[model samples]
Target chain A: MRFEVKNASFSYKNDRKIFEDVNFSVDSGDIVAILGPNGAGKTTLLKCILGILKLESGEALLDGKDVRRMQERELFKRVSYVPQAKNTTAAYTVRDTVLIGLAAELSVFKSPGEAEEERVRKVLKELNIEHLIDKKCNKISGGELQMVLIARALISEPEVLILDEPESNLDFRNQLIVLDTLTKLSKRGIACIFNTHYPSHALQRANKAIILSEGHTVCGDCESTITAEAIEKAFNVKATINEYSDGGNTIKTVVPISVIR
Target chain B: MVEKKSIKILRTVLLIILPIATAIIALMIGRIAISPKDVFLILTGQGDMVETVSRMTVISFRLPRIILALFVGAGLSVAGCAFQGLFANPLATPDTLGVASGASFGAAVAILLGFNAIPVQISSFIFGILAVVLTVLCGRGKGKGMTMIILSGIMIGSLFSALISFVKYVADAESQLPAITYWLMGSLASTDYKSLIVGVPPILIGILILFILRWRMNLLPLTEDEIKSSGTNVLALRAATVLAATAITAASVSMCGQVGWIGLLVPHMVRMRLGSNFKTVVPASISIGAVFLIIVDTVARSLTASEIPISILTAIIGAPFFIYLMRRGGSFR
Candidate 1:
């Protein structure tokens, strides 16, 4: 499915405008990263484009259909959102937490049965976190918990996966684990959109990037959207995009110099 | 880890039997100590050997009260379970939204006006619903969280409590005040068939509705965006929960004023022992809560010649267990 945001804008009451006329579109098997500095409304833009928070004067179209018009049950079945794993509030077990992602399959009177549990098992196995199924979600390591949350999103069987800071607040290894999973999922024809603080993450894995920073908006084609100029403009820091070769794969890393206006 | 399927089935079977066993035991151990055989014989209408007074004690007095206790316990516990999950707060109870205090104020007003049992119950039910509505009105706002609802509940609860005191201030000291005061403390001594007929339906209907909605309610503890994105209408689900919880609580309070702690105590017990699945927690709460109250009521009447208030016994029993569970730190799940 192709998800498109057209002329979208938002602002809080009595607060300055966050963004205006921001337009972007992403399609299946695409890894799109949304990057911005603090208070640039990266998360807020993600929510608005998804119709979670209403756009000020634009529409988010899923396959040319207005998202607001689509029933939530149908919409969520095709699109899934994942919060940061550690943000989980309840002490639900890993299995149950994943089971909740199949909310579209459940009704007021109908709960998940054997078939659903079997699906949960399959999804967890696919994510290689089946071992953590019975463990309390609170007990799992942050990286494992992120995998569990991914399993939850996959269990919903959505075509589009949007995540808020999917790899933030993680150790280097765990960050790699999450980023690699995103690449894997996107390769499987799932459109993965995620918010990130790191510009290199967007440059490294994203085929498409939307940069929301300092009243400047750039979209489409990671090559153009993630330039050193865009980085300096977005994050207000002088930075260099360094290139290194690791095992025949060219890696790009953003190195920050000093704060700049 | 989750329990084995067979063991879970066994626990369910045992839970279903628990209340029946307690109720039967309660029936036999009152002031007039009737034998098991005689109690059974009386129930089966074959008790020629049992005295009329004993039969009356079992059939007319204890039976109605036991049944009342069963409904009251089940209602309060299920409400508590639902409320706790709904708010994602362990301390949230059926009365968390001030339904109990609302009902109590209604009953106090009824007593002050010299109303009978049925009218008192009706008044209580209406006011109970009133309190929940007021709480929602006071608490609801865009992007507000459960804490707002809880704060509103406390505010409304205190408002009703103060109203009850006002009713007492002007109540007939010799008659109405004692009646209102005793009713507020909670008791099952005044239960009869007529009142039960009016009261039990609300509790029963509420339980049945909640049981029907059991699957959807598992989403109760999730964060707002998680729930909103789940494709289900969370507002409808939450509204249904609040309505059902209010109905059962109002009905229970109407039948017997403010039987405290069953909601918190029984649900936590069920959750601690059975895990946090509402699939198990809802039914377990219904079964165990009934049994818990039957035993408590029996002890209340039998332990002392003058009947002790049911609330006192419940608090005496519930507070320590709650503290123990709190200290252990694994029960909330």
Candidate 2:
């Protein structure tokens, strides 16, 4: 499956164009990371793709079909989105929260059946959250909550998964867990598009990277295209790229390395 | 696990027992010293001791009033719970959308226009639906957030309230003014089988709808994208739910005048006990709300020689509990 955005442009009030002529595509089995600083319209771009926000000029298509024309349920069947972490709290059990993912596939009046329950259990186990299944969602740690959210998203068995800042609130171990999970998901032929501020995670997990700056796509490629110059230019910070003996690259901010006297 | 199950069982047992207890107490109070046996006989349609006057008072008058109280209480509370879930805010209630005020204005206008014999019951039902439609139209925004909807409701409510006040001023001083005042204060004094028959259907239908959609209502607090990804149409579902809730609320208010507190407070009481799952919250609210209002209305009628307004009793009880809940951080964000 290919998720394509062709010359997509969006504006808030039909006056201020947030992004103009943004283009990208993600193939099945591809892990694409969108990297940008704050206010770069990375979130907006994701919304445009999800059809939550309207496209001003171009279209976002899934498998050569216009996303806008696809019914919400049909579009959701193919693409699942994990939004930014919400502060809303509910006393719903983790199982209940995850079961809601079956809403699109289930009829309006029917509850999840035996097969769906088994699938939910499997997904919870895969996310290493089987122990937390009966616990209140509001009572979980942030990382666990994120995993629960991801597990919920996976319940739909969507081909394309878009996450906005999945790693934002995670600790180091959880971040690695999420990255590794995305890698495993990609290997299983699921296309994962995640927006992140962390470039190293992108370098480790993403087969392709698209960098947005000032509401425009500045660069697009695999790891080689995301150079220290591009990172420094996009973030407006001075950085030095170090190549390891194992043929890996790390970009570190040189200016922040030394303290002022 | 056994203990938890026992606790749930205990809660369910208590829900059943509490309403019966309240009804017994309600029957025992007031100048009538009807024994439990006679009360039972009257209820079961037997016993020579059940005199014509007492039978009429108990079977026809008090029984219907109590039943109406139960229905109105349950309806308002469930509607409140649904509204809270729909708006994804604790503060959201029937009044939040100005349904009460809108209905009141509609009813008031009908009264002032010499539509007295048209039956206050029918006037309220029509106005209640009208108010909800008007509120929805006024409060609607193009992809706006919950805050915008709430603000729009407040503005519309104020507008309707002002209109109601103006109507009150122009109402015929000799006949309509007093009726309008009594209606505004809210009473079960005029409640009868006729009004109950008209009001109960919509209220029951609305509550049933909320019961069916309770789980889906749980998803409203989540982000739009999250809800969509979960395979639900957030906008359509929310609109439908709000409409259903508002319809019930309007019908209840029009039927019973403006019985406050039950809609706003009963859900909070339920939440305090059972947590916020609509599965437990909706049913608990219905039960507790019905019982609470039934008891209060019983007290209102019994405590005075003449019937007192239900709102006065509700406010007296509900406001202090609301304050206590707020202070105790039950309402803290």
Candidate 3:
């Protein structure tokens, strides 16, 4: 299925545009990475695509239907969103938190039944977080929490998965683990899109990259699009791009050499 | 997950049976003690064997007071649990949105005007609801965060409480002043079947709605953005919950004056035992809260020749227990 954003534009009050004429799309099995410096409207673009924010112009379509016109339940059933981790003091168990993600499927009068519970357990196992089912959310570490959040999102079985900075607070090994999980999900035919501050991560996993810079967007295949020139232009950094063959696949990494104004 | 059937059964038994047992014990222990056999006989329609005064006491005084206490406790505690979830704040209670203070001001105003008991109740109920409506309106728009709703409630509560103080100042010192002061401190001394008849419907209906929505209420403690993204309308759900909770809080305050701490303490007690699942927590709050207030009300009546205010006894019990819970540290999780 085609999930596309066409020339979407948005602005907050006082009218300076956060992003203008931003356009991109990801088909089934495509994993897209969104990369930009801070305040680059990366999160804003994701919000717009998720229908959380109304676009000033243009539209996001899921399977050729305008997302804005779809009911909230229908939209969420098609697309799932994972927000960045924050310190939550609520004392929900990991199972309780994940069960909440089944809201789109649950009728208002019904609590999560045995089938729903079984589905949640299966999703937790899929994300390798089965052991955390009974653990309180506040007791979990950051990486574990992110995995739990992803499991929460995945329980919806959304065709398109959108995540905001899934690896932001994680250590290096944890970051690789999360990124690897996203890549695995994409290979299973769920189109995955996530924002990352680390360009090297996008180079490793994303088939396509969209970089937001100066109220505009650059989108293309990751191999050609996320270049040293693009990083210099988007982030004002002098960076070197290195390539290596890791067995059967070519790996790309971006190393910042110096800061330009 | 393996189900702990024994623990679940024990909790259910304690919740349902404890309150009724407490109510019965309370009925027997007042100044004029009745034997358990006689109390049972009277309750079972065998009052013909009992003395006149004892029969009258059991039916007219103790029964209604106990029933009203149960309703007030359950109403306030359930509302407190819902509001805490809505605001994601453990310390939040029924008065967090100004309903209790507003009801007090209305009762004070009615008292100042020499209104009868029924008029005072109606006035209090109206004003309590009005206060929440005002708070909701004041908190509308871009800054519609939980903190803003709470701040607006505080502002409205302060306003109503100040008005209550002003009414008290102008009241007749010999009679009306003392009555108003007693009411403000809270009591169920005057509660009878009539007041229960007036108060029970709204409280029952409100609690029923909350029970049906208990599982959904679990979502209230999460981020608003996450809630909305999950296909639930956060504003609509919160507004409906607040309205239902407020109806019961208003009804309780009007019936029995302003009993405090049941709202705040009972929910914490329930969470400590039930582990924060609203499905269990809401119902548990009802029974536990009912038992707690009945016990406290029993002391308020039996401890002194003249009845002591319920709020005093509840605060006396609640504050220490709350401190103990906080000290326990892991209790919150």
Candidate 4:
């Protein structure tokens, strides 16, 4: 499966241009990490790709079909989005929250039946969160909430998973856990695109990195795309890209030392 | 799991039995007291001679009030639940969009203009819907959020409330003023079979639509961007929910003046006790709200020879119960 954006442009009220011209694509089994500074329109770009935000010009396509023209059910069956884990005030249980992912599949005016419930159960079990099936979401920790959100997104079994800053609120261990989950999902042939503040995470987990900076974007394989020069260009920070060996695998990490004009 | 199963079964049973029990107790405790045995026989159409007066009293007076109260309570509760879910605010209610205040303003105008009962109800219903429409229009934008909707509702609600106060200021000193004030305070004393025939259908249809959309309603608490990503038409869904909720609220408020608390309180109580599942919350709110208002109405009628306004009793009961809930720190947040 392939999802591509071609010359997509967007502007807000008063003609404030967010994305001047952006282009990127992801094939099945590829993970794309979006890196940028705050307010760089990273989330806006994700929304444009998800078809939640209408483009001012150009289009996004999913598997050679215009995403804007696809029916909601058909489109949702192929692409799932996991939004940033804002603490939802609604006290839905873990099962209740996850079941909503399959809403497009369920017929309107009908509740999920036994078969659908069984599927939800199986997905939660597969995610190793079956024990939290009945727990109210407000009671869960941030890391657990992220896992629950991922489980919700996966319940649809989509070909493409789009996540926005999936590890934003997570601690070090939990960040690793989210990255590990994305890698495993990528290995299963679900194309994953996630934006992150941590470039080290992008270096460690993403096969493809797209750096969105100054209304322009650069997309390529992770190693060449996320260099110290690119990091300096995008964030205006003096940084170094270092290589280290961990358990017989080469790992690249970005270290920021100072701000540059 | 086993305990949950039993609790689910118990809740189902209570949902069925509570309203019936409250209705029976209500029938027995009215102004002309009849024994429960007599009440049962009279209701079943099997009582003879001495029960005839009692039977007429039950059917003509008490029964219509009970039926109207039950439906109005159910309608308001379901609308409240839908609103709470739609705005993702636990404090939202059927009247949050100014339907009650607008309906009161309409009723006050009707009274000042010397319109009769049916015309007054029609006026109230139209104005109630108008208030909500004004709120929606004021809040309309590319992607209006919870804060905008709530803020517009407050604006429209206050406007109508001020209009109501103006109507009262100009109303005749004795007859019209007392009548308008009493109606504004709320009571089921004037409900009859005719009002029930007119009022029940809209409320029932609204409730049915909301129940059918209960699972979809659960999505309302999610962020707007998240809802859009879920692949449903978020704007269309939100409009339908608002329409359904407004229909019930307008109908209920037109028939009975400003009966408060049931709409705001019942849904939270249901969520607190039974979990925040709209599939369960909608139906549970209906049953519990019906019972609560029926009991409150019974108390209103029996506590004094002159009937008490239902709005007062609802606050009297609802405030303390809600405080108790706060102390317990139930699902309210």
Off by over 4 Å in 4: A87-89, B1-3, B47-50, B95-97, B110-122, B133-155, B170-175, B320-333
Indicate the residue-level lDDT of B120 in model 1.
Answer: 79
Clashing pairs in 2: A104-B231
Count clashing residue pairs per candidate: 0, 1, 0, 0
**Candidate 2 lDDT by residue in tens digits, B6-59:** 887898898877776777556655667667777788878795667777777777
Please give each candidate's TM-score.
Answer: 0.94, 0.87, 0.93, 0.93
Tell me which residue pairs clash in candidate 3. none
**Could you say which candidate leads in TM-score?**
1
> What is every candidate's C-alpha DockQ against the true complex, given to 2 decimals?
0.58, 0.43, 0.53, 0.61
Categorize the docking of model 1. medium
**Global lDDT of each model?**
0.85, 0.77, 0.85, 0.83
Interface RMSD score of candidate 1: 2.0
True contacts kept of each: 0.63, 0.44, 0.54, 0.68
Instruction: Provide the lowest-lDDT 10-residue window in model 2 chain B.
Output: B324-333
Candidate 3 residue lDDT tens string, A100-212? 88988888777887788898899999988899999988888999999988988999898999999999989998898899899889989999999999999999899999998
Give the alpha carbon lDDT tens digit for every residue of B1-333 in model 3: 346767777889988999999999899989999999989999999999999899999999999999988888888999998888876766557676788898888878987998876777678878887997887688667885546776888799999999988998999999999888887788888878877877788889888889888899988877766887888888888977887888788778777777877888999877876688787899899998889889889988999999988888888877787557546643222
Off by over 4 Å in 2: A111-120, A214-220, A244-261, B1-29, B47-49, B116-159, B325-333
Pairs of residues at least 3 apart in sequence or in different chains that clash in candidate 4: none
